[model samples]
Target: MELRDYLRILHRNWILILALTVLGGAGAYGYSLLQTPTYEASTQLYVSVRSESSGVSELAQGTNFARQAVVSFVDVVDSALVLDRVIDDLNLNESAQQLAKTIDASSPTNSVIISIKASNPNAEMAASIANSVGTNFANVVVNQLEKPDGNAASLVKVETIEPALVPTSPAAPHTAVNIVLGIILGLGLGLGFAVLRSILDTRIHSLHDIEAATDSPVLGGIALDPDAKKRPLIVHADPRNPRAESFRSLRTNLQFIDVDGASRSFVVSSAGPGEGKSTTTANLAIALAETGARVALVDGDLRLPRVADYMGIEGGVGLTDVLIGRAELVDVLQPWGTGRLFVLPSGRTPPNPSELLGSQAMQRTLEALAEAFDYVLVDAPPLLLVTDAAVVSRFTSGVLMVAASGTTKKPQLTAAVEKLNAIGSRLFGVIVTMLPAKGPDSYGYGAYSYSVQEESVSPSGRGERRARRSKTEET
Candidate 1:
């Protein structure tokens, strides 16, 4: 994917990512609160060797010996030999092995100093344990290990250099660091999930998906309306609505389809049911009629018809009657609204819809209507469900496919297109409906309003000025 694709995914799922990050941080903080606070204290011991010679070389030798011996003494500080004495001195309740687990010993490289650190729940107890371990280790080495003969002075001496102090804060629960790490981990997981979901989802949610699926140019996109079912005739009922404006845009785009002045008849169909193909056909016809063009909207779907109901016209006799020679085209065609639009509703449900639509009579009816009207829009059944749409498409200029955003799948659309190709039918273009108004993949058109001032000559030969309100688009 490109950088823009990743950015769009992030924009679409930002709330999920943010929610997971906050939950991770809160969980880390809660874990920290449940842990026992631990305090650490450290003490340093200095080791030195005595020599009888007063020469500089002899003193250097003694220093080297003490440095080597201090390395070994570091391990002895955490041993049972010292920890057992510490337990006895402090009267602790734990065993020597358990107590040794709380102590740590280390020495700097080539140094005669050994550092002993101890940890406990109590700060004072931590300090006392570190100091006791240091004092006991010194006594064991001087009075027993290094003592030469009875009553003789010891050759090695271990002195307390830096005593351990009680730490003010605990080291185990690094609350701030843990919270930051948790947030980073959560963010990684959330981004991974978002990308995976985008890849796995097959539904078309944006114009980009439609473009990637087919080579057909997108005429226009209609924003989803909550009241679409109640007011399907948006171009007639509410002409200023944004959804209505989108139909006008579709109509404008449709004009360029037949630039050479060929037949302007088009079959409006979808891959599946409920994709807004019927409503789109009715609205586009109304939009074209508003521009003073003669448009005939036909209900070609013999199985089910909706153009008559949406157009608020009589549906007792229409396309089926005309095709069967029961009624003439002029008698069944009903004019709608104040425009030059006409509606030819499906007369009755036929037992053989595919056969009737593909018959020669159907082609003659479309040819007659195409010659009479500037534009003829035939609302057909879903192409994937039956052969009616593909059959009728042969009689018109081409098929106009309607895809619903986030509802139509890529495989379904591809199959629909393949069905048309199998029958040698032309697909004019694609119309995307039910698009979101806001988001990374929303419709890009913005609503705009402007004022136009006009000057007219009055009867007395005086100029009169008037201001008119007009909107280019509405949402």
Candidate 2:
């Protein structure tokens, strides 16, 4: 992934990352608190051969002897042999092997200096162990080199520069270092998880996501109408609203999307219920009708009809009534006052809705509607719930899928698309609805400028238009 992708993931999952980091730090701190305190003590010893009134040969020999013996002495201090004597003299609780674990010995490079260090639970015990090991090693070396002469035979002498002191603080457990390491590890792990999850998520949320998924051009995004509840007839009550503008844009795009195919009917539906399919169809039909072309709005979902409610008309007779020969076309046809927009409600809920919507009568009705109207906007049932949408989509010009933002699952959407594709329905595009507005980066005030202008003019313009009509009638 690119840097921005990783950044977005971090932004989206900051809480998870923070929790893990804090948990790691807390765990390290708890471990540090439970640990026993240990103190370290170290002593520096100078190892050199003692010489008489020196000759050049004697001085060179003494330096060579010191170099060779220093390594041996370091080994001896680290071994069980030297530690056994020291432990016995100090009356230590640990055995020779156990004491070796607490002791460390090292010799400086090109120098006759040796450092001995030891750690113990008590500071005084640590100091005593360091001092005893250095003093005992020196005594053993002197005795081994001694000979029966008036002057002692050539031997090495160990001189103490700094005596071991009881250390106040332990060195094994560094609280800050441990905590920092834990945080780094935890952060790394959390980021890996976030990246993996992002890679696996295939749900379409934005136009960018759809483009990336299907390599299709996103002509425009239709925002969920904020006043959809109060004003259902967006194109009529608020013709200049942004949502109305969006439907008009969709209508225009539809003109180009099917350039080669027959100019025909279109199916508007969703993967699930409450995705604004009926409202979109109603508004789109009105907008299309405003272009001075005949537009027919058909409610294909006979199970749960909403077109009549949106058009503020009766739904007792519509497509079902016409299909069963109970009513004629003119009896159910209701013109929506101004434009060429016409309403075809769902009529009555039928027990055999699936069979009726998929029958030859439904096809004949669509053919008749297509011949008379420039656009046939059919509102069908959700594809996931029933096969009515898929069946109707097969005979229509194309299908426009409506998806609710932040609520639609990727799997459910993919399944719906697959079902439509299996039946050979031409999938046009997806509409994302119910997206949140008030955010730092969202559809800005610029998008709603037309709506604001229309709202301001509607109040005054309505009164003027009414007065003009009244004056014309009186004259």
Candidate 3:
């Protein structure tokens, strides 16, 4: 995917990311509060070798020997030998081996100085341990390691350079650092989860998914309405509503479908059931009739017809009666809403809907309706569930695939397109229904003024009023 795709994923899951980050920081702070606070103290020791006869050469050799010995003495500072003396002097409860775990020793390069650090729960105890360890280490190196004979004085000396002081604050359980690290860890995990979900999820969320899956242009997006089932005929019920306006916009886009103006009939179908194909067809027909166009809305689904129910018309005898010679086409077609729009309901549930719809009699009926009406819209069944839509498409100009946003999967949409392609049916365009009104994947409709003017004035009257206003300004 591109960078914008990743950015969109991040925008969509921003709440989850923020919640995880805050949780991580809070957890780190709580953990820090429960941990024991440790205080650290450090002391430095200076090592020097005694010179003979105050000669420059002897002094240089002694200094070099001391620098080399100090490096090794740093390691011995944290050993059991030095820690044992430190424990004895300070009356520590732990053994030398255990006490050594809290001690650290190091020396700078080419330097005769050794640094020792010790940590404990008590600040005073930590300082005492550091000081005691330095003192005992110096004594051991002078009397035992560097002493030449039993009666002679030691030739090397170790002096305390910087004594350890009691620390005012804890050295471990860094609250601020821990919280920052926790937040960073949480942010990484959140982004990983968001990206993975975006990659794995196949649901159609926006026009981008439709464009990616097929080459057909999206006619328009219908805003989701919770009470859509109650008022299926939105264009007639609420003409000024935004969702109703969307159908009008879809009606405007539909006009440009057949540039040559050869065929006006279209089959509306979806991948599976409950994708708003019937409602879209019914509302679109009403929207077209608003322009004073003669529209014929046919309930083509013989299996389970819904246009009749949604249009509030009688469905006892309609398309099936005409196809079986029981009724004429002009007799079953019912006018709706005192407009030029007509509704042809599915007469009865037939066992062989495919065979009946694909018959030449159904073709002749659609051809006669197309000749009479300005626009003929047939609401067919789902393409995947049956071949009725594909068969109907052969008689119409093209098929309009209506897919539900966030409900129809990409694979399902592709398979539906494939079914149309297999029968060489023209996929005119796509219409996405149930689109959200907000967020990154929302379908945005431009604001339109619906308020009617309270008064009317002609152009000559307005010009005379402007002339009078100019004369008054001159006075």
Candidate 4:
């Protein structure tokens, strides 16, 4: 819709654009190789119509007659009779009708000069065709139009001004011109395709899309955790990993998003499942704990919980037991290693999750947790599937909606945001998941803090250090 939008489309579909350009250029080049070159030659004929007689009346009549004769001869230049003679004189293999196509006769404006042009594969043949057509027409005009009724009439004549020369080069099959035309055509097609695809695609592929859809600022774009399954304790084992760093960056963004207000408790949820909502909650809690803040990771989705599995703890006798008055919160709560992080897993799947979250006791439990911890990160079900997240958000401080970059549609994201706003949930911001590596030029700042770090080292050593840094930086 704007310049930046077009640029984003081009960036996203560069492969398609490159493929189309190469295909069009290759097709044009191959066609140029197959085309036969055609050469052209032209010869001029001048009409001589003099008005010279003894008396004034005779001179006027002679002038009129000469003009009429010249017009008549001009028509006869390409007649079947002229072509038949020209074809035979040139020893052409084609018939008179076919040879007529290669020959053309034209009279210049307000002048008695007629030009004969011919085209052929061979330069010499083209020159010969031009001369032969002119010669045959000259002979026909002198023999038939000048002499009338088998008696000598007042003469009108035409003569060749310049002899037709053999052309040195072809006039067609321009390889350079065709290649340039192909490039223009290819670029137009590629841009058209990019625009069409951008219009058709309704998925959110960038941080801009999330901001536009929800009217919320983008906190950070987190890369997909590549070794997400390799180890469950990503925050503790690989705290400096890029994936972990993203969570810490997100934590920092949250601190400054609206520092004037105090909103510590957050509900982490998405439009649908498998958008990394649970992992994001666990990581955020760990990141916050690393800052020496007491953080509680709550498995609020009693319907289906994953925080316990990710934290490598037993799921029995946790959140459900604490909610149903069967167990104490302190007894079921597990400490996450030696960090100031605590987890409350969903003891078992419950059929009355919405009722439990909406009850007054749930509100009291949230108040108690808020007093005990510095931050409470509740991992809840997807917004579209259930009202658990929305119901829980009424008691929490704010809501942080998670959305997959390419998987979440605009309409779905909008609906999810509207649902939260409809229930009076304070939306903090959106976190964009699964973005490709942001190149320095791509960001338009001409400087990434990471790329600038390489400038401190020598060029020869930069390559090896850059690789090692990338491996260390990437998770």
Candidate 5:
């Protein structure tokens, strides 16, 4: 993924990331509160080599010997020999090995000073332990290690420089530092989880995702409205809504899909059901009619037709009736709004919808409707659900695939495209529906001008046009 993609994921899941970060900080702070307060105290000891010689060369050799001995002396501070003596003197319940864990020793290179530090729950005890450990370690180095033969006076002597003082603050529970580390750790985990979720998510939520799944240019995206179910026919029910504007945008984009004029006759389909194929078809027809163009909206989905219900027109006798010669096109074609747009509702639910849609009579019906109307939009069944759409697509200009954002899966879309390819159906651009109004893939206002002249077809004029159309069909 590119930087933008990572940034998008972070932006999309910022709430989760922030919540986890705070939770981590809270957890660390609570853990620190439960921990015992440990205070640290340190004491310094200066090691020196005593000699009878007063010459400068002899004094330099004594100082060099003290420096070399300090290295070994620092290690002995944490040993059992030194810690056991300190534990006995302080009456500490801990053993020499356990007491050593609380003590640390270090000496600066080329220096004769050895520093011993001890930590404990009690501030006074910590200081006493440090002072006692330093004194015991010094005595052991001078009286024991220096006089290994126990025959003569020892040359090494150690003295105290800085005595340990009682500490007022804790050393282990660094609250501020722990919180910072907790935040850092939380952010890492949150980011890792976000990337994993994005990778595992197979839903098609953006135009780029749809394009990646199929070689189809996205014509337009419809903003998702929570109240869409209450107002499915948005173009007519709520014309000023942003969603209605999107339908108009889709209409405009569909007209200019290619360099030349876009194809007028195409079946709107989806990979699966409930992807807004019917709703898109209804709105697009209304948008086209708003431009003073004669549009024929056909309910091509015979088994489960929605165009008649969405248009509020009679569906007792329409497309199926015309195809079976039971009714003429003009008799059943209903006009909607104050325009030339006509609705060819699916007359009745036929058992063999797929067979009827692919029949020669259905092709002739579509061809005649194509000649009669400037645009013919067929609301067909889902490609994955049934073969009706795939069969009907062969007779139309192309198939306009609709994919619901965050709902449609990539595999379903790919399979739909493959189905179209196998049937040699022209995969006319995609239409992304239910896109969020906010987020990375957001809907925006259009800047380009469209030729939407306000030319309303009067009721009387529509009647005359219907009469003329009927006479022509008869002739």
Candidate 6:
């Protein structure tokens, strides 16, 4: 989409580019080794016209005739007239027609000099062929085209000027040059393939893609953790890990979404399932609770409840029972850990989940919960699957769509945002989750100020550091 995006694609596929370049060079080297080495030898001959007249005009005419005759001699060298005698003198293995392929003849521009070049597998054989072809061409020019000295005035005379030299090395199989060309071709193909993949892939992998499609600001980014399935609540499982630090970063960014406090009561939903929506929601509540704020994480997904399991809390009864008047709101609100965070599981699956989520009772319960706690984070169902989240958003502040990096498609995420907008519900912002653990998308920035004191350094060089939570944006 931009120069930085293309640069990132190249950075990600650098290995592929390097491997293809090496393979191309190797292929070129192997092809060179298999080719037959060829040796070339060249010779030069001078053509002249003799005149008996002592006048300057006659001398000029003779030189002009010789220059015109040189062109005809060049073409005649490849003909059978000269080639037959060359083959007879040198005893070549090829026929006259076949020998033409190995021979090259040409004359310099506005000059009476003809050059003969021959190529062969043997250096000595190539030199002999060039000399033989030149000598035969001279004989053809003197006898067939010009009169003898006794018969009439001799018009043309041809003589060998530079003899052919034995070649010391092969002219073909330029290994280094071939290898360079191969490298160029390989890099071209690699770049083309990288660009093609980036264009064809519709999946979202960065905060830029989300921001380009929606009006919402990018609130935070979560690094991809392959082992997240084993332990969904990473903030509670490993408090000092980098993945947990990402959640805290998200918690900090959430406060700055809107100065009017609309983000405190928003549903976390994705374009589809398996995008770490529940895990992000659970971790955000934990991070918020760490700030001394009372947070209630509700499993609003009647079909697939995960907040209770992720938090390791009771899931037998939750928001559903309270909405149906079967259980009291105070009785079902369960406190977690040593902080003020609470978990409200999605009691049981209901056949009509949409109708119940949009009921008047659901609105009253959400409002009551909102007033009771500082933040009410509802882990609603995916927006694409059902209208429950869209319906529930009317009761809460808005929706915070979490798009999974490298998995959620851009069009799918766009449709989800449009669904909320079509219903006149506000989308708080977007959270890009499960991005690569490194690069620009990672959640380690200068804004997160943390360090260790030099005096606290341990003997093994490991020290206990402290991080001061950011209360507001830097000026």
The number of the candidate with the highest TM-score is 3
Global CA lDDT of candidate 5, please? 0.86
Against the reference, the lDDT scores of all candidates come to 0.88, 0.77, 0.90, 0.79, 0.86, 0.86
What TM-score does candidate 4 reach?
A: 0.83
* Descending-lDDT candidate ranking: 3, 1, 5, 6, 4, 2
Instruction: Report how far off residue 50 is in candidate 3 (Å).
Output: 1.9
Each prediction's TM-score against the native?
0.89, 0.75, 0.91, 0.83, 0.89, 0.89
Q: Number of the top candidate by lDDT?
A: 3
Give the 10-residue window scoring lowest on summed lDDT in candidate 4: 440-449
lDDT of 2 at 75: 82
What TM-score would candidate 2 get against the native? 0.75
Candidate 2 or 1, higher lDDT: 1
lDDT of 4 by residue, 1-475 (tens): 7887777788878888888888778878888889999999999988765555578787667656655566666678878888889878877788888887777777755557788889999999999988998988888887765655766653667689987999998987888888778877887899899889988888887766776698888777677556777765566777655666777788888777553234378889999887878888888888888888888899999888898988889998788777888888889889986658999888988789999888887787777888888888899999999999999999898889988867888999899999998988888888877655463111111111233234355666654334223333321
State the lDDT at 165 in candidate 5. 98
The weakest ten consecutive residues by lDDT in model 3 span 466-475
Clashes of each: 0, 0, 0, 0, 0, 0
Report residue 82 deviation for candidate 4 (angstroms): 2.4
lDDT of 6: 0.86
Better of 3 and 6 by TM-score: 3
| lDDT per residue as tens, model 3, 118-151 | 9999999999989999999998889877788869
* Candidate 1 residue spans exceeding 4 A from truth: 141-154, 259-261, 448-475
Q: For residues 296-413, write the lDDT of model 2, one tens digit per residue.
A: 8999998888889988989888999988889887679889967588888889898999888888888888888888888888999999999999988867887888777655667777
lDDT of 5 by residue, 1-475 (tens): 7898888788778888888888888888988999999999999999999879989999999999999988888889999998889888989898998998898888887999988899999999999999999888888987888875757878998999999999988898999999988888888888888889889998987766886799888888888889988888988897766678778888888887652234369899999999999999999999999999999999999988888888888898988888888888889888889868899999988788888899999999888888788899999999998999999998888899999999999999999999999989998788999888788766564322223344558866762222111111100
What's model 4's lDDT at 293? Answer: 88
> Model 4 off-target regions past 4 Å?
53-76, 91-93, 145-147, 229-233, 257-263, 439-475
**lDDT for 277 (candidate 2):** 82
